[model samples]
Target: MKNTLSPSFSRRSFIKTSALAGGGMLIGFNLFQACKPEAKPPVDISQLNFNDFNAFIKIADNGMVTIFSPNPEIGQGVKTSMPMIIAEELDVSWDNVHVVQGALDTKNFTRQVAGGSQSIRFGWESLRQTGATARQMLINAAAAKWGVDASSCKTENGTIINANGDKLSYGEVVKEAAALEVPENVTLKDPKDFNIIGTDASNVDIDKIITGKPLFGLDYKEEGMAYAVVLRPPAFGKKLESYDDAATKAISGVQDVVRFGDKVAVLAKDTWTAMKGKKALEATWTSDSKLENTEAHDKILTDLLNGKEFKTMRADGDVKKAFAAADQVIERTYESPFLPHNCMEPMNFFADVTEEKVRLVGPIQTPAGTARRVAELLEREAEDVSVEMTRMGGGFGRRLYGDFALEAAEISKLAKRPVKVVYSREDDMTAGIYRPSIKYRISASVKDGKITGYHLKEASINSNMYGLIPNFFPAGAIENYQVDVAAYDSKITTGAWRAPYTNFLSFAEQSFFDELAEILEVDRIKLRLDLLQKVKGTTDERIQYSPERLENVIKVAVEKSGWGNAKEGVYQGFSAYYCHNTHVAEVAEVELENDVPVVKKVTCIVDCGIVVNPLGAKNQIEGGVIDGVGHAMYGDLSFKDGEPQSKNFDKYRLIRINETPIVETHFIENGLSPTGLGEPTLPPAGAAVANAIKAAKGIRLYKQPFIKHMKAKAPLG
Candidate 1:
């Protein structure tokens, strides 16, 4: 693999650069060679130079510093967050730097993905060191010119200050700095001295977004870009059998009709023409491909869980003995249905392909995966394909799969011209690889106010939970805890959603824990605190997660929310979880009106190490909490005879502005490595809201969207 510079300034002073990378353009660029999908190894520290640092910063003679953000900007604001790390260490003012979204150049960039909230955490030190590396180079240049010791020189706000107070702008020293050798090890500023890391920084794209810029996938255009729409099978596991395009060809703008495997694409000069052509076309398929229904699917899962055999993922002590000796055993089943991402912008991509190389531009979460998939199809090396990332309206986790990107490449290759493949909102919703439907059968035994046994068995259709995270809570706390999983295969497409398995499971598990707290007649927070105390007290070094960290955040959340006391009528529920290496605790306030739960407010406390950008982090926390609450209250997707029932926004429900509640957020300052905020804040919200509903309505809810149960209950008096 190619050698990229690590921020570690050990005793050696060498940085590697590939062909097109220069000192001004390449610092902080992660140049990595291709490897297996599941493997990650550091770049060789030797064979290094400044020429190929992957070009994150470019200093013109005019001092216009353009920093290229490597990851995709899918509305999570990595375009601003990632660069802040670099600019902070480089000692440059935010006003002096201009950020550019970097295109997918695998040879020069690694980990350009935008999902899982990993951008900041992964690049935190590397980018900072890169900025530091540049600052040192500029200092070295100034010191040589002034004939002074480098230690006497200090850099600030893109200029070098010599002992005599003479200053040299970074632009004036760019050429000289480019020729200097990098230092072996430079000192990083302590967190207490940070000016940008903990301060408030808004999203840099706000102005462009508000004024309606062409940064989104749908707004992308090329000189000869034609619009193509794919007509997928009506149901899962079905394929196109025959088609009559006589009426389709009659459309004025329709150019050609072609088929790729199970999909047919109608090419037109514009999206409207292609859409119209698609409607006019006549197609037929097998009478029945894979018939799917909610009842049968749910039954299959339940049947699987009843069997004794299960892929036991985690097991502590002997659950049998603990349960057998228990004072009482309580069990409850909770469920959540499949939900679509429903991003503001539908799936779309633009690609230009030729035999030698392929160029792609669009919004995607995993550009490396997209490049790899496209390269695999074209039978070319990964470096031969370049994918450009654009700002997305939203990603959730749908963009993790490169199918939409692959579709664009295929269309571009076939048409032999630049083509933009677009999916209408209807197409996006109906032809979905949705979040897997989940079921939880939770049972616990209580013995004299101390838990004797805890059992959790989760069942799902199609996808087995890939995370299989060993670090889930209660792992190190309970002695006889057991976690099992069962999957019943189906034809429906199931993949990652925002928080994936944890999203629905948290609703079930957290609420179930709340129920157990009542059964044991213990305070909900106390029950969790008791478990956490067990973890912290344990001497085992192999504990899956940090018990000390979990306890700290939970304590802060309780203090900040005033959990036990509420203003007269408002009822509150609390939940906390750790994911993506970040811990979050949330409290939801609810009041019932006309038999419906109205979430009046939600307060969140997050501990993601040192807050990188407080304002941006809070925005993420607020958005994630609201999103989880909305899904728990009203979101659901189902199918009949293998065809989706909700086709568009007119039929599907989304959380509106009026539906948003007052969100108050607070962050814990630990000055540790910053973790991500994109996903961790979302996992606990569903359960917090569900538990609050149970308290207000005087009824326990085991079903998601809690709206499903409201219909059966009479209106509130």
Candidate 2:
């Protein structure tokens, strides 16, 4: 595949070059251009002496290159892949290039977030420009020395060669390149000429990660730092009324107990002592709102879906008329329970707050926003606070909230010393920001064996789906389409979890389409292909998905999975979805054992444009698929009187190694800019499994944690 899009350099992007203190060349460039009108051109590189750009590439006198990646890394492989983009355009040898995580600089960097799986997508052009511009400067420097036109010089493996067959190492021209002017524009390599990209590369930190290095947040420590454990309200809709920490202070190794807001933190010399101190403290809580339960939530959501009040997100045609004229109508409701992030490393952060400055170190997904929030909480300037990011064991949107970081800062300020706040597995699960429980009611009016009218109503806890989601998929496929949303705001905190609303929505919609296919007496894959054909060349600007790309992935999945030709006793399910700027399709193969459906394999096909690193890309795809399968099969979180019923793995169920299926991954090698892969592969797994189960056993599941339904069936043995 070859990329057809031409690289367009932003007029506002500026580059600066300087000499390193140890005799090296440093090139810094801003990948994001300012939104304002074009500013004056940057000063000549000969006069610049500071490093103020968003990303940097430093070449040592020994010809070794170090590229700084300026994004939060949450195990999505941006730390390894982002630098590949820069190194690819720099024309540097992969063996000599080093990658490092850059600190948060709000003024210099933009979109340093890690949630959207967009690190590579958004940085593709600017990062390439940064490297290409530097390569041009080096070529110009060598050309000047050789007394030849810059066009006559070519670079290969970090060496510049002129028409005369003479070569000079990049180290030989480092000083001269540092003196040249920053090029306003540079030509990028065509996709066909890519050497470093579209190839397998090992993770930059794999050696350290495998050898038990101190790379995660929990491994961070500082001299004189106190370990703190906080006791929060036991349940939602409750507040701290009073507390007595006399017993906590009496425990050995206990330093002090400090109260901030509605929570109390027990600071001690070590984590065990802090935990012991927290357990010894006596506290009383009072409920300010009705105690919520899973049953109550279900009732409320169902009521909201049945009610008349709803915010119409998107309405294309007269759905009422279409429904009235239909020969048959199909309606089904899909429900899911709240879910905790369950990050492998729990939540922990180290903070040192003094009168002059505040320092924070943690494995956070949103460093810039967290820094700003922390500064605001402490009534200090944002610039006065600095954040250092560590590699996270697992984020899955859990690390996006900095409540743990905030608690560390508050405790450090009150204790008059540095402190690290750590959460027990119970604290992490019970008091965590959760994926809101939701119910989706979908209805379609059929006439002449075709879906004529489609209506989808969503009721969730707290927030609703993003405004643009209604424009995806079926919105354009059906002429009479309508989407409405309602929410029941609760005291329980809820926010982004992996793919957000689409995670469950994909399963619901995809399963509904499967059922729809059964009623229409049509092939499941053919139904989706025909609907996508209706969305081709749509002029609707609000539609964010590409029908052509989706169709391609679906076709690839069908071909790779051998959709209709599985071996005897093997049943298959298919699902396709578009989210996070990527299109994905999955086929799940299941086998029956004693009347229970067991997933055996999953085939995933993705259209995420160019693959930066095949090795890392496959890791993400397989991980996403397995995660999706596990959550859909056995993951569930219930509540009783506003308290989570499952806080630890003892009661909570996670997919074990024995239960995991073999995942076969494939990608459509389109030459377009890459899209996110971390999340796009997850949303479709649930539906694929559900559909496969339905094929294996003549039963349909309309709720999550499909295990419950599977258990209800009588065993054939």
TM-score of each: 0.92, 0.93
Q: Please, what are the lDDT tens digits per residue for candidate 2 over residues 499-542?
A: 88688999999999999999899998899999999999988888
Query: RMSD for each model, in Å, please?
Result: 7.0, 6.8
Give candidate 1 misplaced runs (Cα > 4 Å).
Answer: 1-54, 288-290, 466-468, 537-544, 713-717
| Candidate 2 ranges with C-alpha deviation above 4 Å | 1-12, 15-54, 466-468, 713-717
- Candidate 1 on 352-410: residue-level lDDT in tens? 89888899988888888888999898777887798877778888999889788899898
Global CA lDDT of candidate 2, please? 0.84
Q: Clashing pairs in model 2? A: none
What TM-score does structure 1 among the candidates reach? 0.92
